[model samples]
Target: MFLFIGLVLFGADRLLLLLESRGHVNWRRTGRRDLSAEPTARLDSLLEDPDRRPVRRP
Candidate 1:
């Protein structure tokens, strides 16, 4: 039982580190752009709209 618990904890810690590393890599690869344009333009719009449509409930 103790061995099983140790393995699970170790696996979870590794997974978290992997996810965090990927995010950092992605940001580094594409972290530059004027705050007033294209891809992020949608983000700005979302932030501005107070009544954005909600996702349909399944």
Candidate 2:
């Protein structure tokens, strides 16, 4: 029982590592995400009036 549990835990860890390598999971503690424009860009895009249509001045 103990060996099975150990193997399962190790397998899970390796799976997480594999997923991290493929960019499917961000589990590292040292990397900084590219959030430089997230806040401002999110606010700008979200606060715009969705019901209004844009006008193009030709």
Candidate 3:
């Protein structure tokens, strides 16, 4: 009984993928943008000490 249920579920998943490939339906295209490449403020600087600047190596 469990085997037949599992097979049916797997087949349904594959059928959805096939339909999605033909542009009949979109299953994963949500309007989401990756902001990691954008310039972000120095959030770490707030935790650091201004007087603790590292010495330059000569």
Candidate 4:
């Protein structure tokens, strides 16, 4: 049972990879995701900034 499940998962992975190669799906990311480069929320921006005044919006 475990072997069958493993085979199915392996087959599915290969099929997805094939689809990704054909550009039918984005199964894998080409570039490494940079969390630091992502846009920060209002609260996070406020915490990171030196000024925490309500009047100031950056």
Which has the greatest lDDT? 4
The C-alpha stretches of model 4 lying farther than 4 A from their native spots are: 29-58
By TM-score, highest first, what's the ranking? 2, 4, 3, 1
lDDT of 1 by residue, 1-58 (tens): 9999999989977776777577743333355756566554466865776567666768
How much is 20 displaced in model 4, in angstroms?
0.3
lDDT of 2 at 17: 82
For 1-58, candidate 3 gives per-residue lDDT tens digits of 9999999999988887788788777555433447887777787876787569886879
The deviation in Å at residue 49 for candidate 2 is: 8.7
Q: Model 2, residue 33: displacement in angstroms?
A: 5.4
lDDT of 4 by residue, 1-58 (tens): 9999999999999999899888788776445558899987888765776555557558
- Those runs of model 1 whose alpha carbons end farther than 4 Å from true positions after fitting are 24-58
Instruction: Tell me model 3's lDDT, rounded to 2 decimals.
Output: 0.77
- Per-candidate Cα RMSD to the true structure, in Å, reads 9.4, 5.4, 12.1, 7.1
Which of 1 and 3 is ahead in TM-score? 3
Better of 3 and 4 by lDDT: 4
Model 3, residue 23: C-alpha shift (Å): 0.7
Which residue pairs clash within candidate 4? none
